[model samples]
Target: MKHTKVKDLLNSTKPVDDVLVKGWVRTFRNNQFIALNDGSIIHNIQCVVDFENTPADTLKRITTGAAVAIKGDLVESKGAGQKYEVQVKNLEILGDSDAEKFPMQPKKHSLEFLRENAHLRVRTNVFGAVMRVRSVLSFAIHQYFQEKGFVYVNTPIITGSDAEGAGEMFQVTSFPLNNAPLNEEGNIDYKQDFFGKETNLTVSGQLEAETFAMALGQVYTFGPTFRAENSNTSRHLAEFWMVEPEVAFNDLDANMDLAEDFIQYVIKYTLDKCEDDLKFLDQRLTDEEKQKPQAERSEMSLLNKLQFVLENNFKRVSYTEAIDILKNSKPNKNKKFNYIIEEWGADLQSEHERYLVEKHFKSPVILFDYPANIKAFYMRLNDDNKTVRAMDILFPGIGEIVGGSQREERLDVLQQKITELGIDEKELWWYLDTRRFGTAVHSGFGLGFERLVLFVTGMTNIRDVIPFPRTPQNAEF
Candidate 1:
């Protein structure tokens, strides 16, 4: 007989008389009862069997974590303490799982322990749930952009220039890491490397994606990106995924609309599909918070806040206003802040960002028109000359979930800014050529995919949600 999924069986009203089921054993009891889960649902169903009636060796062979096929009769089992139960008539061992050596067991394990066994960690309930949610989120991203007529652009993983303008980038080459290359100035010579000049793992695909958007009118790139920053924090990963969407003839407002809608769409999709997973995370969050001081509780109930943000409109504010709020804020009872957000000059820190969103705004807020000095050179210079048409979406717990801006489309302005910023114009020749051909106003943003996943899944550490996370000192799989 063909096997029926546990989920389908749960949903069906018809009596599950004489059914066939096959799955790995989650837990086994008294050599007769076993809990089976094939990841069809978050919760595993308990299967009851009569050990006296079955073959002794067959019962002995059926161990925990082993795959088994059961020819069973499913009855309305109320006394077995399960909503529905399967009583086995005959059992066949498909494969044996080494119960004593398998990394995952019924016992609760720490995240650190799970990280050590990253390859097999997906067997755990938390990881299994997260991977499913991650899968759905990827699909939701494609569906949202595709439905809006946005062309999906596959950007190169290896690039000549760093898109983030950050100096951290991993060198890629066929030669040894230390002895491969050298220049006359006693510097690591890229001339001997694969690209002949220099190339590194792409920090972001925004620039390349912009080229496609200019030609296609609207486009997006979703792929893995690498950064070699030595900082090893819970939030930073050496290798992570990024989503960048560019649109031609779109301004800051249009870009913000896309960001908000994209976020809401993903949140709604997860809630609709992974209700059980979200509930599990919610329980986990509650327990974690309970151990902390009562006053230090998270402001928004993670799950409730997600639903609220998905349904409500996001607030929009200018960088200047955010500064004013920060300045007016009562002097810190603790040490003075390193960078005081004075009227119009400094970059906003994570603490300042959280204050604005959690205290003043009480919701997700888009802080726009940041000071030109702090923003990227490609941002459009406003009439004031001090600020640029840039925006950063700041959420309560996580700061700067999205960063975007209206590109400096004017050739003269872009060229002058590039020169003034001491950037190599030759490196951006192809980009400048886009301006020479047909320059239309354009805007886009880079969403840190891991950060977004952290927000939606209520997972504290970014490493927890990602499979085989790569950090500074740890790349073990």
Candidate 2:
């Protein structure tokens, strides 16, 4: 008989006889009821067995985590929890799970413990829902970009130049470390290496995406990115995915509009498609928060927060204006901030960002026109010659979800900035060609995909939202 997925079975309009179902057993209660899940949805379908007529050996095999196929009659459930259930007439244990050996039993486990057993953690309700939401969010991103006639470009994973200029990058090489060939200056020789030059995993696809955008008009790149920062904080990851969209002939205002619309569309899409998962996560967050102090709890529920963002416009503020607010704010006045706001060129910390979004504005905020020295070299310089046309979208909980800018199009100014920053002119000659030949105002932004998932799912730690988190001192499967 053909097997029916649990999701379809649960949503069936009418009862049917002799339906076949296959899934892993979640729990077996009273030797009669079997809870099964197949990853189609977070909810499990109840399978009731006829214990009186079934053999003891076959019944014992229906343990948690065991795979089974049951031939049964679908009827209205008598239980108050679910709408329908399967009355099993025949049961076969395709795979057995020893009750004593299985790590995930029918009980609550700590998230830390689950992180250790990352391979099997998805079988749980929380991880299952989080992953489903993550998948839907990813699809929504592509759908939004495609609907707007944007071309999707695949950027290279390995590159010879650093995009962010942070110098925290993982080097890609095929040379043996112990006996590496040395050059005349006693440096590692790259002539015999795979790429014949030093290369590393790309930190961002914005640089490559720009080249395509110049030709294609508008393009977006969604792929994995890497960094070698040793911060072991909950929000930091050694490797993660980023979504970058580059558009030709766009300025700072148009770039802000694009980012705001893109984010709201994706959030709305997830809310519409992943209703069940979102509801489960909402309750999970509420229950988890009950254990903490009232001051530590979130101001709004998960659904309410998402709706608020869609309904309200993100507050736009200038970097100089934000500096004045922080300098006069109560936190800075009371000496509560770790880094006090004393001057104009000081970088804003997470505490300051949260104060703006969660306390002062009570909505998402976009801060633009950052200091030129602090921002990337490619951002367009302002008339003041001190600030650049950079913008960062700050969410309520997540500090900075999107970072973007209007790129410099003047060849002379760009080349001067590149020289001042000490970036190799020869290495970036191809990039410079775009400005030299046909210069046009262009803009784009890069979003941390996992951070979006973390906000939507109401997960506090960024690590929990992504599967197989790569952090410092930890790279387990």
Candidate 3:
């Protein structure tokens, strides 16, 4: 059956003779007013039912979560909440829902409870707004990259090499776990596997995308990546999406510019396109902030925090400079930091990064020239040889949103790094060839998609931003 979306119908300029809208029932108020939604938007369209004329059996089926088709006349809404609604002329129950058993009732549900019912949580206003904002943000990402003339490339999911060298990778195997083939050393013989070699789920697409950048000049990979870390923190997930863009002939300065501009553009795009959903989330956040202590509450509202990013220029500082600032910061000096910055080359924790962005700089900061020892082996080594041309864009609430560097284009320096890190050189033979052939100065960054969504939606937990979060011992739908 042909039906108009509730979103379009709600924004109608004038009345319509007959309109059909099929959606799930949100609520049946007094058996006279029906709140129906088809997932076109967060708000439900009100359908006023003529309960006096409708059959008792048909009216009883109009329960929450039930699927129904409403044929009605569209006109101005006398209701306070919505602008326009439907005057139901006919109502047909397409699918019946048991009122006693429907998990998503008309009452408010806690985030934890909603997580358990993840499949049905989208029926709620908050999740509906979040997922809708997520969809628009995804589209904005692609639109921004496409406008910049970047080639969208799909990288392999299974790989024989670890891009980050973190050693937290999920192994892929077809052999029996108990009786896998073994060599003389009694280790599992990878050659007997289905792929004829050991492989694991890819951690990052940066390594593969770099090869394409050499040929295409600018390329990006936006796809799922996996990690095997056992942490169950609100900030981590076993499986998540990554957006890695590699550009040839782009140095550290160009890379930083791209990251800032790209973030601002996509955020503005989402703000413009998903105004209704974002406004809903903004209010949701404001209410949530009310529950917190006065000292802990955010100074700016959600929308203001977003506008802050768009209006201000991200402050650029070297890693050494950040370390110096943190050394004298009140948190570090007063022993309030969990991981104190004692000296240079010290690894900065989330608290430290946040202090630099939220407190010290008082704006988004792009920290560059990080110590080479703390970064991956692929980043280029500076002439002083102590640090690399690396940078991380730090947001106010989010610590490190984007991590990237000017890749080491010199074959010898890269080889030395690979050897120093004890990584098997043969596994990255193809990646190495990118430098051997036509490599010039190149740079790129990897942004966690969930982190971006979390920042945009004002969601505290990383799990809440993604539809189905894969975490330690919890993979339930």
Candidate number with greatest lDDT: 2
The number of residue pairs in model 1 that clash at the backbone is 0
Query: Which tens-of-lDDT digit does each residue in 291-317 have in candidate 1?
Result: 889877896676887876786688999
TM-score, predicted candidate 3 vs. hidden true structure: 0.99
Pairs in steric clash, model 1: none
- Per-model tally of clashing residue pairs: 0, 0, 0
TM agreement with the true structure for every prediction: 0.94, 0.99, 0.99
- Lowest lDDT 10-residue stretch of candidate 3: 353-362
Models, CA RMSD each: 2.1, 1.0, 1.0
Model 1 spans > 4 angstroms off: 79-82, 181-189, 331-343
| Candidate 1 accuracy as lDDT | 0.84
For model 2, how big is the CA root-mean-square deviation?
1.0
Between candidates 2 and 3, name the one with more favorable lDDT.
Answer: 2
Winner on TM-score between 1 and 3 is 3
lDDT of each: 0.84, 0.94, 0.93
Tens digit of per-residue lDDT, candidate 3, span 1-477: 589999989888888879999999999999899999999988889999988999999999999999999998998889798888899999999999999999999997899898899999988988998899889889999999999999999999999999999999999999989899999999899888999999999999999999999999999999999999999899999999999999999999999999999999999999999898899899999999999999998887889889989999999999988988999989889999988889999988888888887787789999999999999999999998999999999987779999999999999999999999999999999999988898799999999999999999998899898898899999997
Model 1 — TM-score against the truth?
Answer: 0.94
